[model samples]
Target: MAGVVTGDDVRITRKVQQLGSSTLAVTLPAEWAREHEVEKGDSVVVQRDESSGSLLVVPDRTLVEDAETTVDASGLDADALGRAVVAQYVLGRRLVHVVDDGPIAPAHRDAVLDAERGLMGVGIVEETTEAMTLRCSIAADDFELPTLLGRLDRTETTMRDDALAAFLDGDAERARAVEQRHAQVDKLFYLLLRVLFATYRNPDLNRAVGVDTGFPLIGYRSVAQDVVLMADAATDLAALTGEPIPATAREHLTGLEDAIDDAADAARNAVVDPSYADVTRAREALDRARNRTDAANESLERERPEPLLRLQRAVCALSGDTRHVRDTLDVATRLTFRDGSGATPE
Candidate 1:
């Protein structure tokens, strides 16, 4: 007799029965089977969850087509409707239909449109007075995790560079543009998260998307999140540049910004072509960024202008982001090393 795993909780015991000569079978729990509309001659999918070593039995119909969810927006407000759509998106739904009894409120309609901007692959495909259909156009075969992550790295690094330039040159136009690019970073981050969650829920999705690797999914997901945080830090740095600062503070800021840029470059190299040497270089860059931050703070006079104080805060935030990048580089380097040698360290 082997135990039956019911849903994500509870367990039941069942005995394996010999079927003819070669097949062995077990009965599904009566309650579970009934709830899922399983009957004799019906098809069910049995998938093995590698992370937990559990067998998952799901209805075949659930997997054969894209899942469509409908959100009733009859009473909920604009923000609530937006959050509902986001929640469904995060849960890996392929399509969401928002419906109301009458014409949808202007605020709610605007909110739904805004959500499409914030999320990747989500867009309004069809809309009427009373209903709207939002579709997630991300095809598993088209956007692989590695490809999306590479895009994330590029976008974040560019944002960081532009932010630094804006701050050093006191260019308000460039600073505003830096802020605009944060939206793209956010979209990419959301897309990466959606792919990660899809892979976790259905391991087959990973293979379908060509993510053929032994590396842990959590590691990739963490690195994607870190990249998003780095982009946000760069946005913060750019925002500070709209105000005027003393020339002395700008001199210190230059060193701090350059150190952060070096750290970004090292991290990018470590992820793309990881080696022990690149890992070491990334670590050294982080150390350099910390030292530069300290130097920048020390160089400020007692009568610091508001802009200089803001710059100091941005430097501290940038230092924290560099540390996060260094941590991700450490994981990537180890994975690359292991894959290359086929050996685990003692």
Candidate 2:
């Protein structure tokens, strides 16, 4: 059994005593047992983290029960109410009760509906005058983090491509479509956050989520955030494309776009497969993206084209903003460090 350590480095310890022949046992803390609703005959699950050599005990009962939270929609406005529901969802709450003492206002009800629509696997099952119930059907074992992250990667890739195509053709409709897909990235991001939080609480979920409990889990979160940031950059680029492009800037911008595509692709793929070759490719791709951006910046400076600042910023984001992906390459790099074979799913 692992010792429970709390604030100020205080550990709750128990003395071990002989129970029977070749058997020894430690007594559970009465308070902890009671708080967990652990009765004499109830089963408790003990999970061990191989990386940290720590054991966690949880009541089996809680695992099977859906976690529910009550959100008092009292003084909160529509936006705040929506955010509150999202917060509860991200915290791994499967059921959220949006309750008001009296009849729910139309604006507040609409906000709740919007929030549900934005979230993955979340739906409204019950609605009444005073309260509404939102249920999240996301099971811990249903989708793995790597799989979900890969989906996000691909979705953003398509979005970036569409945005670029829309920009080159001066198609506002396509650009608007790209902007709308950012919501898809957000849904994946929040769902990943929820799974990560759950796995941290119960290391047993690491296998279910197809990620290691330690750095890989944290690294997945980091990479997901980077993908979201890249989407923002891509969307910003799309919005700017409505104006006429200078011929000189166009060539450099196109080069930067290709460079971004290569770098982002390699990096995201490495995260999924995590081989030494893949990691190296990711690193080299990012380096090339940087060099491409620098060359474009120099060219723009020499030409002094119209909308120079905006063009320059756009050029920079292709490498500067999107290349934030490089920061997460360490995840794949480390995984490949032990063996070029990469981490196998538990």
Candidate 3:
């Protein structure tokens, strides 16, 4: 027999412990009793060990502590779709279910079936007159946070490039297309944020994914916000060029385009490289772009007296666009680097 004492107020007594044919058993630990709020009269749940013929009496609180969430993906089950959801949950999927009541789409149903037997299992748990429930088990190896982030970054880059190119080409139709792309960017950005929220909610999934997502997500968010601004600047530039500008104004616009190109190139490189030295160089180039815009604005003020007021206003608009371009580059550079002491997150 063994005995444990915690001062005079608490004392634990132990008896013989059984092993085999000549085995014996003892009472539960007193410390565990106090920790679990179990008293002499309090009830507990007894769970039998499958392999070891041992009974484990645990407090009810332990069972109720863990929460299981359900993700609804009814009638729209595909192999890829299931895999995607499983992957999402592994990064930390709560309770996910697929239900089909009325006429469900074939593709969706297929996706739901396809998701079965991977990390997530497809099982029919309940049925009703209206709908049937298919539940899936979420496992760890399902989500790759870095890969997802890369995909999102690529999508953002594509949209930004398309919008900037359309504005530079002076094609109103093409610039209009950028608006549609912006909607896509917005959707993607929202989806990524949801994934991040899941990461925070599910700790096991986060450990399994083994990614340092906090920083990258911040960077992507900041960059995405900047790109949205970039898209707006493109829209404004498109409006500025809708009418036939004067020959002098056109020349000035062309120079602004050249300045914008240089600044964009510098910013893109800085964003990709994300080094202090590279950002410093990009910042220098942007400063020069600002000087170019100022010079062009002053030239219009002096050389074109007849339309001086209108010319100045147009110059201001173009300069504002350039300023936005500069700011985007600055943000990209800040996000690229690790030790940005005073930089904003994302």
Leading candidate by lDDT: 2
lDDT of 2 by residue, 66-128 (tens): 499899998999999999999888889989999997999999999999999999999999999
Weakest 10 consecutive residues, lDDT, candidate 3? 61-70
| C-alpha TM-scores of all predictions | 0.78, 0.84, 0.46
> Relative to the true structure, how large is the alpha-carbon lDDT of every model?
0.75, 0.79, 0.52
Instruction: Rank by TM-score, highest first.
Output: 2, 1, 3
What digit string (tens of lDDT, one per residue) describes model 1 on residues 1-346? 3465776747777888999999999988877777767899988767665446677667665342346899999889888998898887866778899999999999989989998889987888999999999998775545777788889988988888888778767899999998999999888877777777666555556666555333556667778888888888888888878666657666666676677677766766656555666666777777877888777666655546566667767667667776777778766666567557444432
lDDT of 3 at 122: 40
The alpha-carbon RMSD values of the candidates against the true structure, listed in the order shown, are 4.7, 4.5, 14.5
Better of 2 and 3 by lDDT: 2
Q: Give per-residue lDDT, candidate 2, residue 149.
A: 92
- Tens digit per residue, CA lDDT, model 3, 214-271: 4443444455555556555545544443433455555655566556556655565555
